[model samples]
Target: MVDFYPLARKAEVLHVPMEVYLMFRAAGGPDILGQSAAVSLLDWFELDTEIIIVMERPSPSMDLVTYSTLHYPLPEDTVRDIMRQLVLAVIDLHNKRVFHRDLKSNNVLIQETEDGIRVRIISFGCGCIVSTIPYTSFTGCLSCAPPELFLERKYMDSPTSVWQIGGVAYELFNEDSKFFNTYEWFIDALGMKTSITASEEGKHFIQVCLEESPSKRISLEELERHPWFFTTT
Candidate 1:
């Protein structure tokens, strides 16, 4: 059995076999109500582990450290499996009318099961309800953030998670940051200066996910049916 006592003392303990922990801002607790709501939906579908809120602690100051060394290239089939799991998880969250707000590689946890790789979306500290007050500012990792998020605009309703997921997929496959690199040369190598393109199928899928117009972006349900995912053999 996984020893969760360390986590239990730090956060509220949910009654689940798997060890899960959640910590939220004391004053901003209501802002993250969507996470609890999403967790409920996952429980209904039997797809999420129970999350218990640990007691609030003073937010810690941390330094930014690039995770360039944490790369392990997986087989193509394994990558597809990870993507499938991520899509299913996101689909379930969208169906429940909750947006993750922050979706990045660090926020996602991967474990190997007897059947295959099991991916779990974690960290709901910044999540908010779909209908909550429109956010005027964005708060997330800049590397994986959508371009629109950087713009100073109120009432951003884009399904930004989709774009972040694509960034995650790119990182998984490349073992290096494509768009999220800090070095100027690395960013240039991504061919951002020119109109870089991928396969027809890849282009279609990535375009929808990275759509500049929030209204034009594809929904999770529609994304699950995209050829990039379905056509994978």
Candidate 2:
């Protein structure tokens, strides 16, 4: 709600979720893309002053924050499970040229059913189509924002998103990592406010994600095949 676009530019911004859905649709529909990652956009309509968007309602579910709180100090296996699914979903989005700028845990949903815990990334209000050019504006959540935004004042697509994933993982292990500012992030190998003890590979993976230099950070493909992913669950 903080970032406001002119009324003339409403469609471009407000329609982000719908456009992304259509893009996923244009990519041979969700059936091909795997609808498990995101919620289905049932329909949409536009009026004079406002627009209405209808989306799927997955019941018996809760946001990741709530889930994590209920099960604080998540086991390495659970963290690996969650991160693996998250990485795949992000890869899917980027492959389709959709950049989910806002990817904090709050925006992710964990659905419980006979199928087990399913992670669904929600809230595309701050999303944008992928681009090579760096974005100057900040539509993402501040808590999980990339460090480059505070340092260089600009960030690209993949790097920032990867950093966000790292931030999520870090918070899962280190509760003190929440609502962290730029200076309050990690210092050395592990975070300064280290809480939980994780495996070496897991720690390495998280560190790589939070790497300050985008060039050194883990790429989405590398992140998917990351050793930590297969080490446990």
Candidate models: Cα lDDT each: 0.50, 0.74
**What tens-digit string does per-residue lDDT give for candidate 2 at 1-233?**
22233222325534333444533432333344425577766555565666566666677789988998899878889988999999998888888777888888888888887878888877776787788999988886776788888888999989988898987887788755464344567453344436545788877888888888888888999999999987853
The digit string of per-residue lDDT tens for model 1 on 1-233 reads 23232223236654432212222211124334333212221221123454444422211211111222333445445555666677777766655444666776666655444654456555565655455456766665656656555553543433677776666655555534344332332346446423333345655665577665667888777878877766653
What TM-score does structure 1 among the candidates reach? 0.60
Worst 10 residues of 1 by lDDT: 56-65
Displacement of the residue 139 alpha carbon in candidate 2, Å: 0.7
